[model samples]
Target chain A: MKSLAELQAIKDKMKDKVVLREGTGEIRVVVGMATCGIAAGARPVLNAFVEGVNKENLSDKVTVSQTGCIGICQYEPVVEVFEAGKEKVTYVKMNAEKAAQVIESHLKNGNVIEKYTIGANQ
Target chain B: MKELSLNILDIAGNSVKAGATKVGITITETDETLSLVFRDNGCGMTKEQVENVTDPFFTTRTTRNVGLGIPFLKLAAEQTGGSFSIESATKEENPGNHGTTTTAFFYKNNIDFTPLGDVISTVTTLIMGSPGIDWVFTHTYGEKETRIDTSEIRAVLGDDVPLDSYEVIEWIKSSLEEEYDSFYK
Candidate 1:
């Protein structure tokens, strides 16, 4: 069994140094994680975001976080992408596979994955 | 919620938003039983509000109409061959006191008790990471018991940053996974 002290040490090491004081070209990926979002499959979506960012070695540039009810439960599991200076792009009804594409096209190549964006789905 | 811990997180979030000063969470896992109890010193709900709490369309807050969290927790408990109950006192023996306590119980099913630890950690992390909320989490497995206080973390954190920010989330995930690996199997 792992001790609490061991866990605390690990936590201290993983603490993020980058602060989002002024955005500074950082990419923010927020996943809805409220009850409806999770029931609709947000966990895998979150895992995908973490995995995709790591796989692309973009962990430093992109930060993934979970948010409570976005007041749009029907569209969950939703993923919102915010580039440093651009308008926020919301992706509705997302899954792990869609998250990967978002990374490949949007995060990497700077082109929005049009088909998965909220505008295309609507 | 995908996992039991997330359910606790949602409920604790509601308590903190309701202006709770202190929250208590207790998890018990033994050979025959698995139980989770959460109590808060927040604004207690009325009888009508309690009745409507399980209704998906009845919400006192303006954020959204669908209230699926408590109902989901009740269902999760029921599905695991267990039960759930909620108690509230708008004005108890004291002249003007109000509080609410919710407890959900589940029976063991030949699975290890390590998952209970994860559930406790999740609740602790969610409450600790949020601002202006204090939480005490107690976990019991047979004769062993562990208690975690968020104030300790707050002492270390000071006013520098929030507890549940991006970095803390990763740490919480990894720590819980490490403590409850067998349960996930």
Candidate 2:
């Protein structure tokens, strides 16, 4: 079990290092976390994004946060990626495996994973 | 919703939105039964309110409700050869102090148990992921049982955020599945 003191420490350490909402050159990865989203496994998907970014050393360039309902309950566990200078890509029905790919190709290499994107499904 | 877990999340969200400080969720499984009970210390509803909660048309929030959450929970429980119930009590000291508790139970042989694992995961994940909310979850598989305390995790993570990050989510998922699978098998 992790503790709150540790999180505060991390937050304290992060205060000067990372600006949360600057939206400058940072890559934003947003996970839908509403009731519908969580039910569809958003928690794991969120985790995968955090881990993938941290592991690949893209923590500074990428920021992950959660949002409320997307109103598309059927296609939940949704993740949206907004790069510094690209169109926003929304991925639906995401799991951990798919999230990893998003981190690698889309977040890091600037290539979207077509099959996982909303446009591909349509 | 398509998945039962979604329904649980929706209902639990209601409890939080209602100003609930503590929520209790229990999942019980036996050779003959499986059940889910969600109890919240939020505002209790009147008889009329309770009756209309499942109507899918009476929403307190301007966000457009149709009361799908509770009704969905009721339907899920019934489809599995179980039943649903809601009870509330008005606070005597505090005029507006009240709470509502909903319980949905399913008998094992009544509905397909294929989704049982998913349901458990959904509820556990939702409870664990939310912060400032105290939840006690109990899972019983025949004679084997376990309980998770969100406060313990909260103690570790502190007040900055209530949920564990992605790494913690994976750890929790595997840990829960490992515990439940032992009884499931």
The weakest ten consecutive residues by lDDT in model 1 chain B span B110-119
lDDT of 2 by residue, A1-122 (tens): 22345545655554444334233447888888765676578877976887788789776678777676777778888898887667898999999999988888888898989898788776
Q: After superposing candidate 2 on the true structure, give the runs of residues whose Cα lies further than 4 Å from its correct spot.
A: A1-28, A33-51, A54-65, A73-77, A82-89, A93-97, A111-122, B1-6, B44-47, B65-67, B89-97, B111-114, B156-178
- Residue-level lDDT tens digits of model 2 in B1-185: 55655666667777777678888878777777767777888876777777787776786756556446677778777877788888775464345647888888876676453355365556555654465688776777877876666776666555443344444455455556666666666
The clash count of every prediction, one per candidate, is 0, 9
Model 1 iRMS: 5.2
Clashing pairs in 2: A2-B156, A3-B156, A3-B157, A4-B156, A4-B157, A4-B158, A47-B166, B44-B99, B56-B66
Taking the candidates in order, what DockQ does each have? Answer: 0.28, 0.25
Q: Which portions of model 1 show Cα errors greater than 4 Å?
A: A1-28, A47-65, A83-85, B1-3, B79-81, B89-99, B110-132, B144-148, B160-162, B165-178, B181-185
Residue A94 lDDT in candidate 2: 98
Q: Lowest lDDT 10-mer window, candidate 2 chain B?
A: B159-168
